[model samples]
Structures are given as C-alpha cells and as structure tokens.
Target: MSSDTYDFIVVGGGTAGLVVASRLSEDPRQRVLVLEAGADTNSDPRIKIPASWVSLQGTDMDWGFRTEPQPLLGGRSIGVSQGKILGGSSSINAQVFVPCNPAVIDHWNSSLGNSGWDWETFSPYYAKAYTTPPVDDSLAVKLGIDGWTGHSSAHGPLPTSFPGNPSHPIRKAWADTFRANGHYQTQDPFIDGAQGSFSCLATVDPVTKERTSAATAYYHPNRARKNLHVLTNATVERIRFDGEDQKRATGVVYNYNGEHREVTCSKEVILAAGALQSPKVLELSGVGNTKFLGKHGIEPVIDLPGVGENLFDHLVNTTSFGAVDDLETLDPLILDPSVGEQAAKDFAERQTGLLTSMGVYTYAYLPIMEHISGEGQKRLKKLLQDNPPAPGDGPDQIRAQAYYKIAERGLLDPKQASGAYLSFIGPWGGPPEPGSRTLTLCVMLSQPLSRGSVHIGSKDISAAPIVDPNYLSNPLDLDLFAEHMLYIETLARSAPLTDLLKHPIIHRDPASDLTDLETARKWVQKNSNSMWHLGGSCAMLPRQMNGVVDSTLKVYGTTNLRIVDSSAIPLMSTANLQATVFAFAERAADLIKEAWSQK
Candidate 1:
C-alpha cells in the first residue's frame, strides 16, 4: 500500500467517526484513516470542566451554523451549533446520558422501515459503548435516587457517572416539587423507557471528574494502533467516486493546511460527519436531490432526495427565575473571582466541586399527554387524525407520523408516545449578580411532527448550508410545545419549587400571568432555541421510500459508502442524542466488519 492509501477512510472524526474508526482498525489487517476538520480539545480547561460546556459554543470549537430565518419565530435566525472539535457535539453537549424511550425505538423498526433498530437488539451496544459508575450510596440517598450501576466496571471505552457533586439547593427543590405534584414517576430511562421523571447520569470520568468525550475514550486510547490513522484540521471537500456509474466511493478529497489532498481506500469510505455536515458532504459530492444539485451547479450523481431532507432537532425554551430566599446557585462562582478560584482549586485537588457537575442532575421525561390541557389534548388528537404531511416532504417523514400514531395510541390508550423532556439548569446559562440567585428550566419537546431540510446554498464547500429546521411548522408541534411550556409554568408555581423561588424573569413584565394559552404560546416561539440534538437529515430506509440509505446503512445507489452518524437515524430519538449515536456507531462498527469479512 502507498503512504496515503488505506483499507478504509472514515470522514469527520466526530463521535461516531471515532467509534467506527477505532472498531474497524481493531483488526491488524485493516488500515483505517480518520479525517477531522477541527483541532483536538487537548485538555483545554474550557472543555475539561463540566460547567464550561456552554462556553465552548460559538468559539472555534463550534461549527456555528445559523439556521435560515424561522418565519414562525418572527423571522429569527437561530444559531444551530455542531461541535467542530474531536468528539463533535458530544464534546460540547450537556453530557446527560439518557437513552431514548424503548417504545420510540420499537416504533422506528415497526413503521419506519429501519428493520433491526429495536431496543432489545441495540441494548447490548449501549452496554458495549460506555460503563457507568456504581451508585454513590451517600449522594443517592441525599438526592433520593437509585438504579445506579457500572461500579464493578465493564470493558467499555466511555465512562458514565453521577457528578462528584451534583446537588444544589435548587436541584432538590425541583425534584421535591415534581414528586409533590405527582409528576415524578419512577421510569428509569436506562432500565426501562419509564415515561416520567428520574435522576440521570453524565458522560464524565468518575476519577478525574473531567468530561469523558468520545475522543478521549474511543479515539485517544486507540491512537497507537498501527492500522489506524487520524488526520485533524482536515476538511473533506467531496467524496471521490470510481468509474462512470459513480457507484463505489474510492476515497475522499480534503483540504489540509491550505492544500487539497486525496487519500485512497482499497476497501471502503465511511462518512461519520454529524447531521449538519454529512448531508452537505453528500450534496457537494453530487448525491443529493436533483433540483438542489443543479441549482448549485453540481452535476447530480445519485439524485437521492433524502440526502438532506427530513431534518429534525429538539427546540428548547429556557426561563430563569430569581430567588431572594436561601437559594445557593452558582452565581458567585462566575461573578466573584474568589469563588471561581476556590472551585478551580477544589476540582484540581480533590476532583470534587460545582465544576464537576454536568449543570443538570435531575430531569423529567414524560408523555406529552401528561402536560397538555384536556382541550389541547383533544385538539392535538384531532390535528393528528387529520394527518397532514408537510409540503415537499418524502415518504420516510410520512412514515415517521405513522410511528407517532403508535405512540399516540400508547398515550391515548395504555401504550406509548413521544415525550416532553425537561431538564433543570442550575445557575442558569449565564450567572446572575454576585449575590443574586437564579434557577433555569429547560423545557423541550423532543420529537416533533415538523420536518425540515439541510442543503448547500452555495457551491463553495466552506459556505454554511441552508438549515431550515422549520420549527413549529406543524400546528400540532407548536401546540404541544406550548403546552409543555405551560406545564413548566405549572412546575414553577408548584408546591416546594414555588416556595424556593420568587418569580420568573421572562421578557414580559407580568411573568406572573402565563395562564393565558395564547400569551404562553408566543413566549415559547420567541425564546425557543436548538437543544443541539440535530439529526434525521439523511434517513435510513428503502430507496423507493426516498431513503438516502438502506437498512444496512449503505447509500441507495452507491457501493463502499456508508453513513454512520446522527445523519442516518431515520427517526430522531426522543432524548439527548449522544448515547443513542454512540450505540448506533457501536452497531455500525459490527455491520462494517460483517460486510467486509466476507469480501
């Protein structure tokens, strides 16, 4: 083999990319290479510290793709962040490790044509990807949480653990209120797809109390493999195809250090770029919709319409409440130098402090039916019964609604449905004054009936793609999200939680009055932002259904090319995407080896 050639080339050194690269190169015979556009995090304090997760956004570490003006959000162009660092969004995300609702996965395979993606089939991959810390009996008792495992330790690369210090006065208040309100049901997301609230874990190393990103656990440990190679600061220009049919992907052309370079693969080319960039690579490589390709002056190769369609993301609405009572948020840690220094010292010395926290220790995952008003529920059901698919959407999206019907039945009858995922943010996105206290609630409606697109607006590869998430486009989605926000308002005014906090600090003066449905609906539209769980752009299904990839994860008309990231998820999991993406890559790794071992 030549110096630049390999048996496999995996693009986008992100979470899934690293997983696939590491597993594929496990064999001494296979040569694998990874191309990443961003620099490695390299023990950067901003990235290592759990509390600094939000600070990484908009920095050089973030892809920072601003969405097209959402007409529904009063023409606001929301910033959709994709991690430009080694682990992709997993590196910058909140690090919560909740798996999707089991029924949601069942719905995917049953109705969405994704044949083998059920929970039972994928559960082992979850155990294979990461190991959790054992139940901290002391902290568990204080938090009133259980179901913790992984202390005996498994052999997975990534680590999952409760923060050495996850407790806050506000955190306890929120949990107590949820329980007091009868909303806190014991549905352990990891053990079962329990629909109600529970304590969750984070993707952080237990000993070091540092963020255990995909790069740290999956890629760095395997860096010394002779068959594996990683190329950082290299951006994939386009996939290189073989012969006139363009059926087989030979390698990729990428820009590294101001020069365009090509690496050939004897076996296959895999694209593990996250949702936003993977589809752009497809469009740039001439594998997207016919009209979109022609408009960008790129000759169409496969004309697969699903390459950049079916875009879905979780939109979050956050509100900060000010408390004048005996609340101790992280405000002083950021506003006062002495407190910040003390936190840094504690983490460095004992690996224990507020800095070790993933910001959110407790969260709720309940059926949307639990939150919606009776009138709203009837209206939502009627809207879905109407079953209106968006204009220009393909068959896979129509199928997604069918799966929703399953969940709808589960909700209406004694079955399953999509969830409204709400996580409490202690200390808020930004700190308040030195002595002021603030509590933030991140209200999210995870699965949406709304569908959107991601397409390259310019022929230039570096230009940002047109990402129209089309948030709140579906009347049902808008209505459901609004109901969830109202439910949060209810939580805000509930028993123990209400007693802890004073009042919310929304844009409106009369934040006290969120009772009116229309007023609350408008508040959600203006304040909602991407939860950063963007996916479902290049769906996996049959070709006739306008699927970009098949059940095997191979592109419809191409050979030796596969998408192994968030982009290939046919239906967006109704939870944080990091754990789901990790398991998917673990499964994809096996699929890749199976495909080639026979060859």
Candidate 2:
C-alpha cells in the first residue's frame, strides 16, 4: 500500500473516529488513518480526571466555538466546547453515564423507518462499548444491573462509588423533608422506560479515581499499531469528489504543518467530525442543496436538502439556594485540606469523597401531564369537569393548576434552590420564557421545533462553519417551558423549602413580576442560553428523508463513505449524546466489519 492511501481514511480522531479506526486496525490487512484537528490528549490533566473538566473550557485543547447570537436567548452568543484532541469532546465532558430514552428510540425506529435503532436491538452495542466500574452491593442496588450496560461492577474497568461524605444534619433534614413533601427516593434512574430520583455515578477509575474517557478507554492502549496513523494539529478542508460522478467521495484534502496535501482512500472515507462540523464538510463537498451551495460559490453535487438541518441542543438553567440555615456552599474539609486531613484521606482510600458530588444530588423528570396518555385522558376530563378554569382562563392556567396539584405532592423544592437551572430537553428544538427570583425556574426545551442549517465559512477546511441553530422559534415549546416554570414557583412557596429561603432573602428583579404578559415575555427573551449539547447537523436517515447516510452507517451518495459520529443521530436523544455516540460507533464497527468481509 502507498503511504498516501489506505483501506480507510477516518476523519477526526475523536471518540467515534478513534473507535472505528482502532477496531478496523485490528485487521493488519486493512490500514486506517485518523486525522485530528487538535493536539494529542497526553498533556492535558483536565482530560484525565472527571472532576477536572471544569478547568478545560476555552483552553487550547478545546475548540471553544461560539455560536451566532440567538434571538431567543437574549441574542447572546452561547459557548460550545468540543475536544479538539484525540478523544474529541469526550475528553472534556462531565462523565455522566445515562441511557437513551426508550421513547426516543421508538420514535427513531417507528417514525423514522430506521429498523435497528430500537432499544431492544441496540442494547447489545451499548453493552459492547461500555466498561462498567466496580460497585458494592449498596451502589449496585441503587443503580440496577438488570437491563443496564452489563453489571460489570464486580471486575469492570470503570469504578462506580457513592459519595462517602456523611450526610450533614441539615442535609439529612432537608432530604427527609423532601420525602414528607411527597417526593420518594428512587433506586435506579436508568431502568428501561423508567424515570425517578436517584444518585448516579461518573465515568472514572475505581483505583485512581480519575475520569475514564474514550481517548483512554479506546486509543491510548493501542497507540502502537503500525497501520494506525494518528495526526494532530491538522485540519480537514473537505472530501474531494470527481465532478463526472458527484456521488463519489474519492478522498480528502487537508492542511498539516502549514502545507496542503491530498490523500486518497482506496476503499472508504469515514467522517466523524461531529455534529457541528459534519454538515459543514458535506456543504463544502457540494452534497447539500444546490441553491445554498451556489450562494456560497461552491459547485453542487449530491443536492441533498437535509444535509445541514435538524439541529438540536439542551439548555440548563441552574440556581443554588440555601436549603438550610447552615451554608452548603463549599465543604472546607473536602475542597481544602487546611481545614481537615480526614477528608483527603477518605477521598484517597475510598473513591467516594466530597469532590465526587453532583451539586444537585437528585435529578427529577416530569412529563407534560395535560397531554394525557392513552390511559389518562378520561381521568383528566373527569377532573376538569368537576373544577374547570374560569371561562377566559387559557390552557396555561389549566396546566398551572395541574402543576400545583403535583407540586403539593412535593417532588420539587423551588425555595430550596437559590435559582432555576435551565436544562435543555431532547428530540428537536427548544424555547424560552419569563419568571422571577434571583434564580428563575426554566426548562431546557431540549426538543425544539425550529430547524437550522450549517454551511462552510470559506474554502479553508480548518475554518469552522457558520452555524445557525434558530433556537426557540416554536411557540408550543415556549408554552411548555413556561408551564414548568410556574410549577417550580409553586414548589418554591411550599413549607420546608420556604423556610430555607426566608433566612437568605432570595431576591428577584421586579421587572420579572410584571402583571402584563408582554412585559414578562421581554424578560425571558433577555436571558436564555444553550446547554451546549449540539447535534444532528449530519443526520442519519433513509433514502426518503434525503439523508446523508444509511442504516449501515455508510454515506448515502458514496459507496465507501461512512459516517460514525454525533452527526449521524437522526434525532437527538433525551439523554446526553456522548454515551449513545459510543454505542453508535460500536454498532458501526460491526457493520463495517461485515461489509469488509463481503469484499
């Protein structure tokens, strides 16, 4: 084989690309080349420890890309961080291990005609990619092993441990109050088709207490493979194609060491450049809508209309409250050892420590109740028949009434929270709304109805794309978010949590409390931002959807071109996209192996 050519040229040595390149290189007969846009992951300490991630933002290792001003989010530019290193964003993300919701999968399989993506079918791939941590009986009992990524706890590579910090009297009292208010503690949060409040674990090493990322899990152990060439500080411009047959993706043109070079792929070219860059590559390659291409002075190729559409992200609105008279701000014993040596000893001996804390210990999920399920429509109707809203009260008021009823049961404590944490929902797009207090309650609007596109900024491959997410263009999304905010308001005014808030005098701007609806709308417009979970710019779809790739993970217009990255998710899953992305790569590897065998 020539030095310039290989069996596969995998673009982007991050999570998905590295997984595919590693698995493919297992066969010495086939050569795999992984091109990365940033440096190697070896020197970054932040990449090694899970808790160290907060320090990595805007660093050289991160792409640190900023989005165009969002109209819904007060026209503020949101920050997006992607690892430019070998592991991709996985090298920098908080190692939260959550699963794709079953409802999300069913929507993909049943509605999108992607047959193999359903939960039952994709379960094996998830298990294949995951290396579970060791867990004691207590932790395992809390996070069930029945249907999760195999109970590898006994001898798994990853380490899973609960926080060892003994619950403070105030913390215990508050948690107890939560139960009295009606919110019950749950065992496992990831059980199939289930939602509940439970303590969770991060992806870390049991022995070292370090974060376990894809770069470490997949690439570091196999760095010596002769056929595997990993290049860093090199940016990909676009896939080169033969004009005679625009469908064929021949090779890629990239710049490394300040020089331009063309590399050919003997068999295939796989794109794992992620959600934001994948579509930009396609547009640069002339595979998107001709008009959009022509407007940018690029020649048209595949003319796929949906190449850069369907952008989705999550938004997080976080507020901290003084739930108890004693401050929970920072545990001196845990954060700084000058106060206590026992805290450090506990953290070192057992992986459980104060640093392992997820500020918000409990995360709850509440479905929009008014949209009654097949079983609850009549019950809702009957309840409404007995106590209907006043003649002119809108659906928001009706929903607010139901929200208050649920709040009475006490799952959420608004007052305990210093402010609202706006977290993005999943599926499509999201919306924004107005509220009060130093911290206002808000929804992530993870799933939004608005669609946006991504196109190349110029011919320079290393240059990032022009991204337009068009956030919060849907009214229904805004309404749902507003309903949840009101529910939180009710929760904040409830008993136990209210006591905590009274001492600290949590204040809100008077502007947020306007009686006129339009005035309140302005406040919401000035304060929304993204959760930074951007995806679906290069969606996987059937031929009918005019998608970029097929179920086999192969690029639609080219025989040897495949995409194994976040760009391939047809629709955003309700959970974080990282874990699901690993599963996608795991499954893509199997398909690639099978296709290779046929030849």
Candidate 3:
C-alpha cells in the first residue's frame, strides 16, 4: 500500500472543506489534501444553474436519504437531499441568501462560550466570501441596515444581488402591502437582522450571472498548486485511530476505485463531510455512546453522548399558484429566453441582471403571525376546551404542551397507525400589496425538543445517511407552528387581502377530515416536508459537554480532527443556512491560517 501524507487532510471537498483547504494551501507552505466521496462540480448542471437544482434530487450527485417513517407526517418517509459533490449542498439549493438574526448569533456565542462566535466577529467572513452587486438602490430605504458586515457593495469574486425586474408587479405589490402593514422591508438582513422583507444575494459570476460555488471560488482558482491534491469518488470507510494515545486520528481508510487505501494527516484531519456524515464517521470509528455501540456490537472509543443528539431541521411546505395569464408561473426564467430576453441575453453576454437571480427570490417575516388559526383553531379549542386544564395551566398553555409532545414524537393513529398533528392556517392578506401575488402560510417550529439519529447506511461514502428528522415530536411544537400558520392566515383573510383574493381562491390538495381541526391536522401530516437544512449532528461545544468539536472547530477527543461545516453549528440559525455556512467555512480558513502562523 502506498502511503500519502500531508500537513492537513480535509474530508469532503464540499463548501466548508474547500474553504478550509483553499485558505490553508494559500500559505504556499502547508500541504492540504481534500478527499471527496462524490463527483466533481463541473459535470453537474443541477449545481450550476439555480433553477435546475430541483431536478437533481434523488440523482447520484445527491445522497437521497429517507427518514424512518414519520408518524406526524402520515407515516410517510420524507426525502432528504445532500450534495455528494465538490461544492456540497451549495452547488444545489434555491440560493436564498439570508443571514441569521443577531439574536441567534448572540445565543450561539453565549452557548459556545466563545466571544469570537458573535455576529461582529463572524461578519467579515461573510464579506470575504461574496461580492455584493448593486440592486435597485431602492433597497437603501426599504432595507434599514446598509453599512453592516458583508452587506456592503464591495467588489469580489462572488456576485450578489436581486433580479433586475423589481417590477415583477407581483413582488412589488407584496412588498408594498408589507410596508403598509408596518412590516419593515430590510436589505441584506444579515448585516442588520433577518426581521423584514429583503432581496437575497447569491454567489454568482458578476458578468455571467452564474453561481460561483466553492469549486469556482476555492478549487478552480488554486488547482495549479502542487501542495493541494483532491481525490474524487473516494469513499472513506473510517478513521484509523492511534491506540497509543487514543486521542490522535492519524489517518483515514477509504475505498477508492474498488480498492482500500489509507491516507495520513500529519498535523490534523478535518472533517468537513457535513453534519450527517461527520457523526456517522465518528461512530463508525468507535467514538460515540457506549450503550448504543454495545447494543449494535460496535466498540466504543469515546463515550460522546451528543454525537448524534441535538439533531434538528427546517420544515417547509410549498404553496404554488398558476398565474391567471401566461405569466410564467414556477417556470425556468434563467434558462428560458422568452421569459426575460434582455436579462438572459445580458447574462449570456456579460453575467449580470435578472439572469443572475436565484428563481425563488425575496423574503419577508410576519412578526405578528401567531402559531395557529382558521379551521384547526376552532377544532383544537373545542377538543381540548373540555379536557381538564393541567395544574394551573391555561387553555393555550395546556394545548401547547400537548401539541409539542405530539409533534416531537410524531402523532400516531393506532387504527391506521398514522401519528401526526396539523394546525389550521388562514389567508388574511390581499390586494394593494406590492408583491402579494398569492398567499402562502408557511409553518416552522423553533427549538424542536425531539431527538433523532444519523448513521452510516453502508461502507459506500456516497450512500446517504439514515436520517430521521422526527417532525412534530413535541405537542408544543405543533402549537408554535400553528401560531405561525394562523398569523399568516389572518393576513391572508384580512380586509385588504380578503378583498383581493375574493375571486376563486387556490386550495391545497386536501389531506384532512371534514372537520376544520381534523382537516388542518391531516393536511400538515401529509404535506409537511423538510426545508433540506440539516444540522447539529457533529455539534460544536466544549469538550466536557460531549460536543464533537471546539469553538476553533477542532474535534473534542482527537487533536488532529476538526469540523468546519454546518454540522459544527450547535443550533439552527434564523435565516437560510447557505450564507452562514459559507461564512463559517471562510472563518475556519482564517483560524487555520492563524494557527499555522503561530506554529
């Protein structure tokens, strides 16, 4: 067996791993090797064009894993997609670029006991990762925070902006309605806070309007470097532990080209294989809970109880509409020339304008939107109205507790054995709103109390993890989701919105009983799916807390092991995970550089 050695060995040359490798190798002295268990980025179109990503699901480029039947979701197994390619999930996403709320950053910092984790310290990295483009200068007034963090108009490799047509008429109306309702329209909320309506930016080519993923930003730029070697189609089996100290991860054993190979990391081994795979790698290498390993007959090296604990994800349901005219509803505007000829032509010729827009652009927050409303509200109130209140608890409080448990473990129907609870939502808002084309009441619960696991399905690194996000395990979870739903419904069915939608309204494929509460519950059970943001598996925490890695991203038990991807996030952020993930990866690079400088 030929042994290859490097100063740093990075597993999974996706987003975070690539950033680490690129930044480390930039020193031109330290050697960095990235091992990817999937394909390179160039061949995947679903990754390049923002609109084409939907088709990429279940393909080889994606580790299409399904959950253990979720009782809350009608006993249905939800599909989870993670990129099995160089750029990772960033190569394939809706490209909605939003930042975490400052509160979220502060909470993370306080929990991790690291001052550097705060938004102020982490803000620069966001700037370093992308170049913000000029979009309707109208954003200055609409979006309050203009001068903070990476929200500046600084030019760089990654392009950021909204599509050229702010006149989309629908979006414009929606924005106007939000403003009239007193909701602040924010710009680059990551800079100020994710609390209002704002246009998100994507990492794309400034001239070409193409996505500038980790492959283009990191690998492609430095492919000529001799110190950096990337191996594709390499499925890592497990890490080779050093019995001498038991805390040293000396190298990795992997299956390459139908043969087993071992590669050594002299200084350190960083696992940027993401949240799901990282924990599985640790368990397979014998670094997890002793009891669980004993049950599986697998030896336990480190008794880290939190290896797969603290698992949570974002759940979202889509409410799409068919335009009254041939208004190109849910159509591919980037690829189809007829939709926006000038912008597409400009993108083809230059790389700017709407051609650069990620199809699903624009975001707003309904602050007043409560967790429940409409059909389910009356039903839940009636069902639990007579149920004796628990020890001084009010009706809302009692109901919340019940719904939380139901959502956390997943509701089960012993008869049909379908366990899940659904909350009712309303369509309250209507016409006169700038961007109000249709009403969509989204349900997202915060701080899920249910615990789940992720493990290696087989030796194939390309194979997806056995993921069970266990939605609606707690009864309170349902209530919180219901609160958000009802809030939106209120806006949809309110005076203005009601008047606009007075004509024939759109309805979801009904998934509930005839009663309002039953119908809402069934709808949620049948429709609730993941937003594809998976994290908290290889969580970042102090060593004593059973955390996988430290604040600096170094693994807890092993000196040579570090994690720099979304998996390292101890908790979920307020906004989408892309910008934050990219920022963290970039920050990890700086930390790595600083460490090498001291050495």
Best by lDDT: 1
Q: Candidate 1: where is the Cα deviation over 4 Å?
A: 147-155, 164-188, 243-246, 369-377, 390-407, 410-417, 423-434, 503-513
Candidate 2 residue spans exceeding 4 A from truth: 138-194, 243-246, 325-361, 369-443, 489-524
Query: In model 1, which range of ten residues has the least summed lDDT?
Result: 146-155
Tell me the TM-score of each prediction against the true structure. Answer: 0.92, 0.78, 0.80
Cα deviation of 382, candidate 1, in Å: 2.8
Ranking of all candidate structures by their TM-score, best first: 1, 3, 2
How much is 64 displaced in model 1, in angstroms?
A: 1.4
The sequence of per-residue lDDT tens digits that candidate 1 reaches over residues 1-599 is 34799999999999999999999988989999999999997478988898888788899999988999999988999988888988888788888887777777776688777888788898678778988676546665456463323123445899888664655555456557667756564534565554566666788888888998889998889899888889899999999886666588988999999999998989889999889889999999989889988988998888798888888898887666766456555666777888889999999898887688766776776665442557756766676776655444556655555646654665554234345555444454445655666666667776787878898888898898889989988777777677677676666677776776765533223452467568778877877788878888888866656788887899888878999999899777767888889989999999999998888
Question: Rank order by lDDT, top first?
Answer: 1, 3, 2
Model 2 agreement with the true structure over 1-599: per-residue lDDT tens digits: 34998789988988888888888988989888888988876445456544456668889888888778887877787787878787888778766655555556655676566777787777556657765555555434333221233333222222344322324222333334445554433434333532422333456565666666667777778878888888887788889876355356779988899899889887888899888888887888887778878887888777677687767676554322323324332334333445345534555576555444322233334444333254434543443345433343443243234323322222122211111222111111111112211222344443444456666777666677777777656443454444444444444555554554534334233343433335434544565556567777777766555566777877766777788898888766554566678778878888899997989
Residue 354 local lDDT, model 3: 47
**Model 3 per-residue lDDT tens digits across residues 384-500:** 344322453543343234334332222221111011111111121112122223334344543444445676655445566678777877554454444444344444544333443
Of the pair 1 and 3, which is ahead by TM-score? 1
Give the CA lDDT, 0 to 100, for residue 20 in model 1: 92
